[model samples]
Target: MTAHIEQAPLVRRVFWRLAPTRLFADLISKSWMESVIPFVLFVGIFTYLYIANPAFGTIGNLQSISASFSEFAFPAIAVGLTLISGGIDLSVGAIFALVDFAVLFMIGVWGLPTWLAILLAIALGGVIGAINGFLIGFMKTRPVLTTLVALIIYRSIFNLITLNYSEELAVIYIEDPTWNFIATGRILGAPVSAATLVIFAVVAHVILRNTKLGWRVAAVGSSKKAARHAGINYPLVLFLTYCGAGMVTALGAIFYAARLGSVAGPTGQGLEIQALSAVVVGGISLAGGRGTVARAVLGAAIVFLIQNGLTNIGLPGYFTAGILGFVVILAVGADIRWEKNKGKAIEKTLVNPIVFSFASTPDTSPGSQSPLALNDRLKDAEGLAVGLIEGPEDVVVDRLGRIYTGERQGRIIRFSPPYFNEREVFARIGGRPLGLVFDKDENLIVCVAGMGLFQVDQQGKVEKLTDRTTRNWLSILDNSRLRMADDLDIAPDGKIYFSDATDRFDLHDWTYDSLEGRGNGRLCVYDPATKKTRTISHGLNFANGICLAHDGRSVFVAETWAARVRRYWLEGPKKGKLEVFLDNLAGVPDNINRASDGTYWMAFAGMRSPMYDISMRHPGVRLRMLKQLPRDEWLFPSMNHGCLVKFDESGRILESYWDKKAEKHPMLTSMREHKGYLYLGGLENNRIGRIQLPDADQNWTAHDSYWGKS
Candidate 1:
């Protein structure tokens, strides 16, 4: 098999090895990609106009466009907010016309001050919105029907008032500085209306994304029943949401009246349809609970550009309207398709397996002179809590000689000493806890597989220390959240150092990480003083074990799939330096811990087989195997055999122990030396093993070695 794999074409090997670059597929699957369609349309439309018409690019024409864009954007945003709350506001156009008439009547006919007229017009819009809010939100009327009725009533009132006062409105024209400036003014080289739109967009975005009210609105929109169950006042949220929409619409109306200073029977007509088209084109989901203020503004810009640009290019009004109508239909169809297939697309391309080259395996047969020679020493080891616990991946002993270990069921189990029969649950952390250690204060610090670092105090209360670190700026995926925190150890200065096994896969999908054979792991440290966690070293292959050296100058970390151990300097002349400590191990290394005699004991969770080694060298075969065969049939490392080894500070293997008969311990994951006994733990074993070391110090405890006696 090895010869055949090596003899395959070089081009095939290179193609398989480059599979790691498929991470781009993951980037394309993010929610931000929803804006791509609208953004592309905006850019394409703008570019076409700039190249086709010289007047479109002038500063004065651009400013006019900006003012018109702002005017249209306000109504679009007003409609978009209602959509986000799972309702449609068809009365937006009517309310806009009524507010415009109110502003014109007060300022021109009643001879009111500009400021007073603007305030009264805005208040009038709010009152109309409150009526709609009361009907649709409190009275439980269908949103579409209630808003349609409001549109008829409000439009009729506007027409009646304008019919009686048209001659009066036309005869009197009051010129006020405030009104004139609002109509045609610039702030920082931008139109006043444009500046106001920018400010409003920023505030709306923050409210929707960063506030509790915004979260409640989204929750209610997603599912009213769910929001009610979660203690959200569903009716109240809708009411306030509509009220806000009304006030915003009125503000836009004020700008429109100031710009034109007149009204007609068709003023603000068909604005509801235009706003709805703008929002849908800008990527606002029609079903609600998903959109942004920026998207709303972008959609408004697209609509305005299409209409204004078509007119400028001599297209008839009916032709421009027809084109926009078609665009809206296409946008809605695309939105539905994207919402349905985004997850499927992401899952299909998430796993990208890469090629790896393996060196020759060393001999570890019985009676061999190699330091990693197998033995039956662990076969006779005594089992503690047999059949009572599941997957005690790591074992630790406190100063009282009490045994502690983590189970696969997200629980820490404790067993009393003497006969070792008394058992109790220490803590229920709700995540598969992998590594266990006791800090100086006797708090149990754990590295939870799917969760991040946690601390369990004497009372068994769990507190999360940190779940996220600084993200890599260049990484396509968000790598800040710890995906799989596998193992950890503390420094003398109270800083906690740990290994994140893989940033890509969670605990259950860890086997995929090995199949990919890529470096997706990093070593991080959590400082107690600053309450911050930061990455120290990255690009490690399944970094599993972490053990601070006995001298406190460096730490040793195991790269499981790489079959190597690394040493990172902490305080010596080589501080901030990382180098390989041991290379080419006989098996896949797991947890590493200190021994009483100043050495470290490491567990091999699985041993490498010839078939698995050959598979690693040929990623193309593995990729095909993954696609064709069932998961259980895929070739993986040999995890049925148990093995442990002891090494000194110089990285020399002193001895090896193995359960050659597979009787007691079938797979070793961790080992700790305390009071002359070696406690064994396994990832899939139902019991903990203990074997006495006659030549070791019987009086030493790990707690005493790290922090001295209390």
Candidate 2:
């Protein structure tokens, strides 16, 4: 037992320790520390400072430190936003200086009201930002070069103002209570600067995560081309993000200059570097559209701490520079480390395979697992007498051990077992039939790509249950479950549960569906008694497969586009909540069926290329791909290599089976085990393949075949 336990992970660990594969694996695995790392660093470094210098821990000193952090924090956040859009705003520093001067000049020199000056400062910043956006977005200038040039131009104008216009600045008073409050005063116990931080944090957080802007910004960053194809205005998204960043930075500068009571030559200068550093520290990549505002703030806090710590300890400028360099190198290293170790990281998230083995028992193993580098094809069936099935999308079985398959020409056909003989069309539908499940009443419940839910009775009579339950746009738009009804399974309560894979695109346009990468598929329950379908869960990604748990307390649904499997608990502490049962699956799971041994069998509509799987982890990469490439050349979920995977109710993967090419199983979308044989169906193939399951019941074909049989 000990030896077997030790041997279990030997291959996996060896594979992971191999640097190339390990690095690829890590990059794809998500890090919870992504959000928590900054906090840990904040506490750790600050605690050390407090212990080293007593004054640093004092409330008054802390207030000043927090104030200091917020001023830079705002500009850094702006930089973070632009960076996420795959650009940089070198003018963030210049804009801040101008806003400071503008506010002072507008209010102090021109006799404008406080509110008016603030508004003008904000408006001017937005306009200038629009100029930056126009250059980068419309002119097609490179982000770094364009922003760098703007930085220089703005600096020249700023210096000219200082050199020639000090006389105009003379009219401004050195102090005003209102401006002072913005910079230094408090409301109740909270510092005003702290309040600014909180406000920006909240607003930025919502825009980047909860709003359309957030998604659009991410889309542009990932791939402008793909975003446009998905109907997103690429340039507009970039322009608006830049505009918003400019406004936020300008406001922050208002507070900064207000605190100082003047706009001087040194005001708002060289701050962009600090902001960039902070954003990188917070995990926002220079590559774009991946990090958050909170991360940028965290990066800003780290910078503030570093500056303060080095100054107090009297470190040399060179050493301080070295520390900043070291920090950058370290963050990048960490990010790279994470990216490369993705598969290893995913392997860690799964329950131990030993525990997984317990779910399948001694006779069973997972069937959808990837095979060993496909050295050769199966030899025994190399010369068998067999009839080929043409373009079979899904395969089902009746109680007498006969196989039923949904074919390409909108028909379901049946084939006798052994040498897999003569096929005959069982029923006809309007379009392709993808998922097939034999229900309690011996009706084959199916998902028809264009037609919706359907059933085939014994004599091949077709019955449409409910397919257009969801509006096409509201179905699977954005590669989510817009409207393409693909697959289904029956619930124990006799309800027909199915997947509307996408409302956005049809079966042939599956690639477009993947590029959108938005949640769209929905899970619906069709009550046969009333012939009504109600959406049970909305916002799934290409909802490809459905299976109710053996106990019927929960259901497992596959979100193929997201490479995720989620469990919806009907009765538990976590009822009605969808939780990630499995994520970053090695394959795109297509359908789920009950196995004879009290487990489920899932077909991999596609297998994941390690490179592609890792790319999903980087929002910037995907968005960027969308922006640059035409739809066809872009990345897609690879269904060419397909498999049959088995899992228990608790999501323990038992084992897997694989066919490396379309020649064997091509996009195997569904599978059902019947009477000692596991039958496979392919969405794009012209044949149904059969594998003998040694211990499976040989008496049963599909339960539907036993209709009226004694």
* RMSD each, Å: 2.8, 12.8
- Give the alpha-carbon lDDT of every model: 0.88, 0.71
lDDT per residue as tens, model 1, 1-710: 01122344677667875664466565676667778889999988988888889799899999988987887789899899888888889989999999988998899888899999988888888888888988988998989999999999999998999999889877767689998899999999998999999999999989998999998888877888999999999899899888888888998888998888888899889999999999999999899888878888889989998999988988899999998999999999998998888777766666677666666676798899988888888878999998888999999998899888999889999998887777799999988999999999999999998899999998999999999877876677788999999999999999999999999898878888888888899999999799999999988999999999999999999999988899999987899999989887889999999988999999999998889888887776777887788888989877889689999998899998999988889999999888999999999999999999999999989899899888
Task: Candidate 2: list runs displaced more than 4 Å.
Answer: 1-28, 35-39, 163-171, 174-180, 225-232, 316-318, 333-352, 355-710
- 392-494 in candidate 2: lDDT tens per residue? 6777777666677776678887776555567677888868877887888677888888778888888889988775573434311122232567777666668
Model 1 pairs in collision:
none
lDDT of 1: 0.88
Query: 504 in model 2: Cα distance from truth in Å?
Result: 25
lDDT minimum window of 10 residues, candidate 2: 352-361
Candidate 2 total steric clashes: 68
Over 4 Å off, model 1: 1-21, 111-113, 628-630
Over the full model, what C-alpha lDDT does candidate 2 score relative to the true structure? 0.71
Where does the lowest 10-residue lDDT sum fall in candidate 1? 1-10
